[model samples]
Target: MGDVIRTVKVKLDVRRERCDDLHQTKDQFLHCANTTAEWAWRHPDEYCVTSKQKAETALYDRLRDETELTANLVQKGIRRAIEATKSGVARLKNGETTSQPHFDAWSVVYDKRSATFHRDHVSLSTVNGRIECPYVLPDDPEQTPIGEYLLNEDYEFRMSTLQYDRSSGEFYLHARMRRAEREEHEQSTTAFSDAEHRTVLGVDLNVDGSLAVTSTGAFIGNADEMNHRRREFEKTRGSMQQTGTRSAHLSIQSMDDREHRWMQNELHRASNQILEEARDHECTHIAFENLTDIRDRMPGVKRFHAWAFRRLYEYVEYKAEMLGIEIEQVSPAYTSQRCSKCGFTHEENGRSKHQFACQKCEYELNADYNASKNIARKLLKRLHSGQTSSSGGAPCQCALTSGTLNLNGEFIASVDSTAEGESTDKPTTSVVGN
Candidate 1:
């Protein structure tokens, strides 16, 4: 059976005394981790992949006598520290030593064998003692509680980490678990899963907003409003920096976390809306531009920072994976400058910010819409050329679609097409002429 790894967050409600005990244990854990790392850093003769297990065994035997900590945690800390040092050495050997690993956080790692879970509470092994804490689950009426879900036969318990969130003053437990892959496809829910019915949805992400245009529909986010809010926050940060007071500096420090959370919510909402559009359109394949080198192409745009785009893509990616959708990121070369109609590339084709007009062919359309079509075409070419994912499935049929998707989940269109059995004014593949 195929496996999927997922991380779940649980809120920890422990007694004040237990909290203090856990905090002190975290200190000890970090201290031991640093010590192990430093020892590995100083001793180059004792490191080898073949003897890593032996090294861990020796460290385990020696650490137990030195630190008054649990057995599993000590092993994990030492192994993790050594692995971290090895990674640093590799990076340095590659001629890049901008930063090294630091054991800055205070936390405890727990394996499944040492931890136990009940319906809504959990017991963790700490140096002071085993502390029991109840967790708060999200408001999902359709799903069972996390604890009960873990107890199911199909689910497997995995490693977990208990950490203290200083800002919230509450304990949080993050558990990494796995489960057997579900059969979301072949159940008559989506066209991508059905062999005969398939379509590709091309998504274009811009600093102003995002556009997901498919054969039957398109989704657009409220990027302008989101950008406005971000700029306002940036101005506030600028003012705070100007004061240069201790309080101002503290405010500046606190702004990052708050802004990050806000950006995350905004991006998540946008991605969810796009996925909903794809589902409605029955699109099986989703294509996005590989923006790895986008920084060099368009620099100094705060909204287009690599992390922002990465986070947005990650949200869509995980959601897509859960639904059996095939996704690929094509190289971004001239999606914006090239004309989708006559294959003409010119510097002046996209002189305007919102519209694209081919100087040679005189074909005009929305700039993002044109880019979306190009992205879809790129993937279609790859699909027909026998460049499928490792599973090596055949290509899916798709139509070139165009339109606008508003934040209110409303789709306004200049051109639209209907899914396989739906009634609409337009036919699929109307523009691609396939």
Candidate 2:
């Protein structure tokens, strides 16, 4: 395992009189970052800059002349702007629809030179000067123990962000801390370094039916229940809108809030379920389909359902990282139609919404389950071949609790894919363009 970095979020107890200073600082930082981003976007040559030296050489002086930010804060803003611009440019190059980077959030970055850490309070730089703001730890035990890690000597503080929540009228410091990797975690991760030894959990997400299905034959989340709840919300909202009364509009607002909270809770539970499945199976990695251009791929899916897939992946990603399990995304190109049994490639293979029957090999299984097996195979293929291989190659294998699937996708007793020799040549199964 490598060194671990964690972000600690705790409220900042700031007096009313000092709030304006922070507001001004955040506004200036936003202006600086956006201005720098706009300039970089206009000139891609400048935005391709990655190193701190290049960023300083290109944006440092210009940002300083435009804003009242200090040298350290100005540098931080320039670096942040560079990152945003690079990400946007990369996404655009990848053929993903994206707009120019924009910074509109109420946030300010502080480095060691600009901020000081104390037991009870943090000294932060603002437009006025350095201000000592006490930390407000969460009262609930279930919440993150802010003091447990922040005050520990083993963790070293890094650059952090100061943010304000307009609705709560509270300021927060997202402090980044790092510590060396633990010996036990290193031992566990050493096993992951071996491609053939690693156990992977393949997850398939859907808009209808079950939300997520694993290669291990575990299904999670009820899309029907979620759709029913959403329909009820829509029905209630429509009725309130027809009433056209002030109280009805207020009720509609409350209903929207309630629905959002419920959706978040559902997604969190689904993510937790996925983590449990991976851990139960002793998987080193969890594989998912690449969600880029998901809307185009799933043209019939609603916007909310598409958003749910992305949100669920994000939730699982952070939670999985804590357990030293890695998340991997495989190509979504032929995962559905390609047969996990004989590496057959045909459109009709995934015959229906729920069933997958390969045309060449006559292999049949649940459609999502088959796709999930393909997802796991894609990752395993990449690990063994050092690249993502064509879907028509020798079929990759998967491990189950009682048995493992062979190249033909039969349930025979085995351990890992290495137990059998895989063919380097393509399969005889008829194929179509991917």
Could you give candidate 2's per-residue lDDT for residues 1-434 as a string of tens digits?
Answer: 57778898889999999999999888888877877776667543443444544555466545655776665677678778879877877887798876667888888898666788765679998778889999986675344556566766677677788999999999999988877677744564455343335566788888878888876667788877888899999998998899999999999999987887788779878988888877766676788999878888865567778878876886687567558676779888899999876889899998688888889978777788788878877776665454532222323445443344544456554344233322121211111010
> How well does candidate 2 match the true structure in TM-score terms?
0.52
- Candidate 1 per-residue lDDT, tens place, 1-434, comes to 35676666777888887887788778767766776766666434544232334445345435645666665566667767767877777766688763334587857777653467554678887777788898766676236535444435455556778878889898987776667466633432453345544566777777664433333335356656767777888899999899999999888778866776676677767677667756665667778889677777764446345666666676676567557677778876788898866779888998987778889978877777677767766776676566763223444444344332322223334333333221122322213211
Superposed on all Cα atoms, the candidates' RMSDs to the truth, in angstroms, are 20.7, 20.2
* CA lDDT of each prediction against the hidden true structure: 0.64, 0.73
Question: For every model shown, what is its TM-score relative to the native structure?
Answer: 0.48, 0.52
Poorly placed runs, candidate 1 (over 4 Å)? 1-193, 209-219, 390-395, 402-434
Winner by lDDT:
2
Which parts of model 2 are misplaced by more than 4 Å? Answer: 1-196, 387-434
Q: What is the Cα-based lDDT of residue 92 in candidate 1?
A: 60
